[model samples]
Target chain A: MIPVDIPLWADLLASLLMITGGALTLIGSLGLLRLPDLFARIHGPTLNNSLGLGSVLLASILIASIQADRLVFQEVLITLFVVATAPVTAMLLMRAGMYRRRADGGKKKAPQPDEST
Target chain B: MTTLLPFAVSFALIAFALAMIFAGIRLLRGPAAEDRVLALDTLYVNSMITALTLGIQFGDRLYFDIALLIALFGFVGSAAMAKFLLRGEVIEP
Candidate 1:
C-alpha cells in the first residue's frame, strides 16, 4: 500500500474511527451467532447498521476528503441508504420468522395453516 | 502518527475480515431459515466495512463505489428473501 501525504490529525482520526468501527462490527456478528434465538440474533447486526457503519463511513469521509483536498460527499450516500433500509429489512425478516414459527410450533395436532401462494 | 496509524488501519482490516468470517460461519450453521438470513445480512454489511477499510488503507476513492453497491444489493436481496419467507412468494395481489 502506497503511503499518502495525510496530515497527522486526519490519520489519527481515521485510525480511531476504523478501530472502533471494526470492533463494533465484530461484536455485532458475534452476537448474531451466539444469541440463543432468531429474534435475539437478529439484533446483533443492527449495531452494524447504526454505529458500526457510521464510524467506518466517518473514517472514509475524513480520509477521502483529506486526500481529495475538497468536500467529497459520495460516502454519505451509503450512510443515508443504510439508515433508510436496515430497519425495514430487519422488521420484515423478524415478522417472517415469527410467522413461520407460529405456524410450525402447533405440534402437528392442529390443522396446519395454508401457505399456498 | 506514522507508525501507529498504519498499524491501526491494518489491525482494523484484519478485524473486519474476522467479522465477515464469523458471519459466514453463522450463515452456514444457523438452524432457522430466518437466522440464516440474518447472518447473511451481517455478512454483507461486514464485507462493506471491509471495503471501506480498504479505501482508508490504500488511500483510494474507488472502493467507496464498490462498498456502496454492496450495501444496495445486500439490502434488496435480504429484504426480498425475508418477504418470500413471510408469504411464500415475493409478489402477491
Candidate 2:
C-alpha cells in the first residue's frame, strides 16, 4: 500500500543492505557490553566501524542514487573518513590504555638494570 | 518492495536506538578513564549512524552533512582524549 517511487530492485537491494547493516551494528554494541575488561571491549567498536557502517553507507548511497536518478555519492565521504580514522583512534586508545596500566603499576614488573655485567 | 522498505527502515532505526543505549550504558559504567573514552567514541559513531538512517528514512540530503560533521568531530574528540590520557595533556609543550 505504500507509494514507493524507486524501482523494486533498488528497493529490495537497499532494504537488504539496511537490514544487514543494522544487525551488524547491533551485534557490535552487544559485544561492547558483554566483553570483559577494557582491552577486550576495545575490539567491539571496530566491528561497527568497518563492516557495519560500511554496509549502512552503501545502502545510503544506493538509495540516494536511485532516488535522484544519478550517482549521489556523498556518503562515500563518510566511508572514507571512517576508514581513515578508525585505526588511528583504535591505536591511540590502545596506547593510552597501556600507558594508564603501566602508570598504575601494571601486572608485569619493569626490567631492572643489568647489575651482573 | 514498497512495503518492505518501510519495515526495513524501521527495523534499522530500532536497532540503532538499542545500540546507542548499550553504548551509553558502557559510557556511564566503564571503570577506567580509557574505557569511558572508548565508550564515548562508540557513542558518537552510533549517533552518526542514526543520523544517516534518518536521512534514508526521510529522503533528505541535509542529514548527510550532519553525519559528516559528527564523524569529523567525533574523531577529533576521541583523539584529543586519548592523547591527553597518554601525555597528561592534549597538546605537548
Candidate 3:
C-alpha cells in the first residue's frame, strides 16, 4: 500500500466543501418537490448546476491533488461543460413549456405581437 | 483519512440518490408535460453528481470522463425534448 497522507487542513477544507455542496444539492432537490409549477421547478436544478456542481468539483480537485501529491485538473473540464450546457438547456425547456402552454390554450398572458412573431 | 473519506462520500452519495428518487417521483406524477421535463432535468443533475461521487470512491480518473459524457448526452437529450415540446415537432425538414 502506498502510504498517502494529506495535510489536516486540506482534508478539513475538502470535507467542508463536499458536505456543503451535497447539502445544497439536497436543498435544490427539495425545491423541485416543493415548487408548484414547471417554471419554479426549473429554478431548483439551475441552482444545483451553478453552485452545487461547482462546489463539488472544487472539492474533488482539491482533495485528489492533495492525496495524490499531484494536481488534478480534469474536474475543471467537467465544470466548464456543465456550466455552459445548463443555461442553454434551461432556456430551451422554458421556451418549450411556454409553447406547449400556448398550444394547449392554458391561461397565460398573451405575448405582444412583434415583428418577429 | 481513508475511513473518514469513505464514510463521507458514501453518506453524501446516499443523500443525493434519495433526492433523485424524489425528483423521479415528481416526474412521474406531473400533471403537465413541462413539469415532467423539469423533473427529468433534476434527475439528470443528481445522477451526474452521483457519478462524481463514485469517481471519488474508486479513485479512478475514468469515472470523471464518464460523468462528463453523461453531462454532454444529458444536455442533448434535454434540448431535444424541449424542442419537441416547443414546435410540436423535433425536426423541420
Candidate 4:
C-alpha cells in the first residue's frame, strides 16, 4: 500500500538528480582508467567522493523527505562524514607514496650509500 | 512517491556500485601501494553511499547510522594505512 501518485515535477527532478550522480560516478571511473599515474588516478576517486556521492545523497534526501512526509536529515550526516574524510585519506596516501619513493632511492638525485666503508 | 523512489534509489546505487567495482580494479592493478590506498578510499566512500541508498529504499533510519559508523572506521583505517606507508610503521616505540 504505497501511493502511486507523485507530481510529475517531483518525479522529473528526482530522476534528473539521480542520473547526474550516476553519470558523474561513471565519468570518475573512466578517469581512473585514463589517468597516467598514482597521483593522477587519485583525482578520479576524489571526484567520486565529492560530486558523485554528494549528488546521490542529496537525491536520496529529497526523495525520502517527499515520500515520508517529514524532514529526514540522516543522509546529510553521511554526506558530511564522507566529505570530511576523503581528502584527509587522499593526502595521507599521497604522502606515503612520496616517502616510499624516496626511501627506495627513486629520486633522481638520491645519494647512493658509500660502497667502500 | 514509491514509484519514483525505487527508480531513483536503484539508479544511484547501481552507479555508486559500479564506481566501487572500478576502484577495486584499480586497487588490484595498482603499480604502487599509494594507488591501492587511493582506490580503497574510493571504495569506502561508495559503500557509505550504498548504505544510504539502502536506508532510503527500506525506510529504515538505522541503516544511516551504520553508514556513519562505516565512514568513521574507513577514515581511521585509511589514515593508519597512510601512516604505515609514510613512516613504514603505524606505531612508534
Candidate 5:
C-alpha cells in the first residue's frame, strides 16, 4: 500500500537504485557458483555486501522517509550493522578455511623455492 | 509512490530469489566446507533483502523489525559456523 503522491523523479530514482542493487546481488551469488576455488569465491559476496546492500538500503530509506513524511533514517542502522559485520565474518570464515586446509594437510602453505643449478 | 516502486520490488524479489537458488546450488555442491558456509551466509543476506523489499512494497514497519532480527541471527549463525570450523568444537571454552 505505497502512497501515490511521490514524485516521478523520486520513484524513478528508487527504481534505478533497486535494480542496480538486485543485479549486483545476483551477480555476486553467481560468482559463488562459477568461481574456481573457495578463496576466490569469497570475493563475490563482498561485492554484494558493500555496494549491493548499500544501494538497496539507500533506496528503502529514501522511500520510507518519503512515505513517513519525516526524517526516518533508521534503515541506516542496518547499513552500519552490515558494513561492520561483513568483513568480520569474511575474515573469520577465511581463517576457518585456512585451518581446515591445514588440518587436512591440503594446499594451505607456500611452495618451497627451488635453487636447482 | 507510483508504479515504479512496485515494479522495482517485484523485480528485486524475482532476481534475489534466483540468486538464492544459485547460492543453494553452491551450498549443496560444496567441494569444501567453507564453500558451503559461504553459500549459507549469502543465502541469509539475500533472504533479508527479499524481506526488506516486501516491507517496502507494503509500506509496513514491522517488516523492518523482522529484517533486523534476521540480520542479527544470520550474523550469529555465520559466526558460530566459522568458529566451529576454526576449532573442532562449538562450546569448548
Candidate 6:
C-alpha cells in the first residue's frame, strides 16, 4: 500500500467531494444515453459541465493545496476556462440543431403559412 | 480518513470511465451530427475528470496540465463541428 500523508480532515473532505462529483457525472452521462431526443440529450452534458465538473475540480484543488502547504490553485484555471466556454458550445450546438431541423422542412406541423400567402 | 481517500478516488475513476463509455455510445449512435458533437464534448469532459482522478491517485500535478489541454482542444473541436453543421462550413468566407 502506498503511503498517503494527507491529514485526516482534508482527506475526509476531499473524499466526500470526489464521490459526490463522480456520482453527478455518472448521472449526467446516463441521461445522455436515455434521453429520447436531441434537445433532451443536450441537458445531460450541461449537467456534466456545470456541477459535476465543478465539484471534481474543487476536490482536485483541495488535495493539491493541502499537499503543497500553500494556495495551489492552478486547477482553478481549468474551471474558469470550462465555465467560460461550455455555454458557448451549448448555444452553438442548439442553434445548429434548430437550423438543421428547419432545413429539413420544419417539424411535424408545417410552419404556419404567411398571411400574405 | 486516510483509508477513505483511496476508496473515493477509485470510485471516482470508475464513475468517470463509465461516463466516458456512455458518451462514446451516444457519439456512435447519434441520429444527427449535432448529437454526435455534443457526445464528443461530453467525452472530453469525462476524460478530464478521469485525468484529475488519476492525479489524485498518483499525487502528481502533471495531470492537471493534461486536463487543461484536453479542455482547451475539446472545446475547439466541438465548437468547430457545431459551426460546420450550422453553416455547412467551419469558417465562413
Residue lDDT tens for model 3, A5-103:
766676667667678778888888888888877766788877789888887788778766765778988898888888788898888888776655544
What residue pairs clash in candidate 5, if any at all? none
Better of 2 and 3 by lDDT: 2
Q: Which prediction has the highest DockQ against the true structure? A: 5
| Candidate models: Cα lDDT each | 0.83, 0.86, 0.77, 0.74, 0.84, 0.86
Per-residue accuracy of model 6 over B1-93 as CA lDDT, tens digit each: 236888998898899999999999999998888889999999999998898888878879889989999999999999999889888899987
- Model 1 docking grade: medium
Candidate 1 CA-lDDT value: 0.83
Worst 10 residues of 5 chain A by lDDT: A108-117
Candidate 4 lDDT tens digits, B3-87: 6656766777788778888888988998888888777877887787778667766767677788889889989998999888888
Clashing pairs in 4: none
Give Cα distance to truth, residue B31, candidate 2, Å: 0.4
TM of each candidate vs. truth: 0.89, 0.90, 0.88, 0.82, 0.90, 0.91
Give every prediction's interface RMSD: 1.4, 2.0, 2.4, 2.4, 1.0, 1.5
Which lDDT tens digits does candidate 2 get at residues B1-93? Answer: 235788888999999899989999988987898889998999899899989989988888899999999999999999999898988999887
Chain A vs native chain A, TM-score per candidate: 0.83, 0.81, 0.83, 0.81, 0.84, 0.82
Q: Score the docking of each candidate (DockQ).
A: 0.74, 0.69, 0.56, 0.54, 0.76, 0.75
Clashing pairs in 6: none
For model 5, give the RMSD to the true fold: 4.0
Instruction: Write candidate 4's Cα lDDT for A1-117 as tens digits.
Output: 113565677667767777777778877876777898766677887777887778777766776777788886677777777767778888887666655665443434323334354
Per-residue error (Å), model 6, residue A33: 1.0
lDDT of 6 at B78: 90
Ten-residue region with minimum lDDT total, candidate 3 chain B: B1-10
